[model samples]
Target: MVPMRTIAHCDLLPDLIQQLLESNSDTHLIVCATRPEFLLHLTAAIRSQRADPDTAASHDLLTKTIGLLARSSKIRLAFCPTLESLRAYLAVLGANSNESTEEIRSRDRQLLSILDMVAMHVTTSEFSAQGLSRTLASAVEAAYSAGMDLRLYECTNALDPSSAVWGRKLWDMSVPSLNGSVRMRGDESTWGGRGVTVKRVAERWFEFDHSH
Candidate 1:
C-alpha cells in the first residue's frame, strides 16, 4: 500500500522543503507564505543539484510541483503580507472548503463582497477604524456559521507591566469556555532562570491545573 501523504505549513522552515523533495518522490508538495527571494533561492539550489544530463527531468519536477499547488483541494497555499491577513484568509478558506465545490465558490464570492464593502468604507476615510472592525467581524461571523474555529491573538506591549496584566486578564476571561486550553509564560525566577516555563490553565473548573 502507498503511504499516506502529509501536508505541512512551509512558512516555518526551508529545510522542510528539502526533506519533502528527498522523501516524497511521488507526493504532491504545496508551498505557502514563501517570499520571492526564498523561492528564487530554492529554485536555484534545485537547478544546481540537477543530475539529469539534459536537466529536463529536474525542470519537469519543478513544473509538476507548481501545477499540483495550483489545482490541489487537499492543499491550499496562500501568501499574505501580514499574519492577520493570513489568518483571515485561512478562516474563510477553512469555512468554505468544508462543503461542496459549488458551495465553496459561493462562500468565496460572499467573502469578496465583504472585503469590497470594507475597502469602500476605508477609501471614504469615514469611520475607517469602525469599518475595518466591522469587516473582520463579518468575516469571523461567516466563518463561525460555516463551523470554522476563528481566534484573534492578543497583542502585548512587553515594556508595560499594565499591558501584560490586562493581557493575562483577557486571556483568563476568554479561555474558560473554549474547548481548547490557554497558557501563560512563567517568570524565569521561578525555575532559577534556566529554561522556559509554561503554565496551563484549565478549560473547566473540574479539570486539574498543570505546568511545564
Candidate 2:
C-alpha cells in the first residue's frame, strides 16, 4: 500500500480505502481525522486549478495549494480550526457518551486536540446558540477534567465554568439566561447523560439524540 501523505490523488481515495480495508491486503494506510473531509476540498481546488490553466485562479492556485501544504502541516499538529472538524473528531470518539461502544472510541485523546482548536475559534454567538450545546456537552462528558481548555471558549471575558450558561446543564435549552456569555458546563467525569448526538440536524448542526 502506498502511503500518500496528503491524499493528494483524490481520485485514488476509493482504491486506497479498498486496499486498507480489504482483509486480504498485506499493507495498511493511516490517515488523520480531517483527511477524508478535507480531501473533498482539496479535490475541488485541484480541479479548479486544472480546468483553466490561464485563469487567475489557476495562477494563484500554484502557491495556494491548501491541500498539499496544509494537509501535511495540520495533520502533524494537534488542534482543528472549524466546528465541523471539531465535531467530526469528537464523533470519532463514539456516537453515544463516548463509552467506546466500538473500537473507534479509543481515539478520544486525539479528538481532544481538535476541540481545543475549535474552542479557540468559537465565539459567544456560537457558544450560546442552542445548536452547539449538545456536541460541546458530549465532549465535556467524555473527559472534562482532562479537556478543560477544549470545552470553554471566550471571545471577551474569561470563561467561568461554574457560572457560565453552559454550566446549567440545560439539555432542553429551556433556560433563558440574560448573560449571553457562553462557557462549557456539565458533569465531566462520565458521559452519563444523553451526550452529543451524532445525527446531522443541518449542514453544520448536529443535534443530540439518545438513540444514536
Give the per-residue lDDT of model 1 (tens digit) for 1-212. 11111112221122333333443332222222246733654555455435345554544444557744443343223444343554476466546655764563444222111111221221222212233344345545554444332222222222232532222222332122121222335741122212221112211111211210
* Tens digits of lDDT, candidate 2, 15-114: 2222223223222122322554445634544454465656534343344455444333322233344556555655554343433334333333332322
- Model 2 steric clash pairs: 197-208
Worst 10 residues of 1 by lDDT: 197-206
Score residue 156 of candidate 1 by CA lDDT. 23
TM-score of each: 0.28, 0.24
On TM-score, the candidate that comes out on top is 1
Off by over 4 Å in 1: 1-35, 51-76, 98-212
Candidate 1, overall lDDT? 0.32
Error at 200, model 2, angstroms: 26
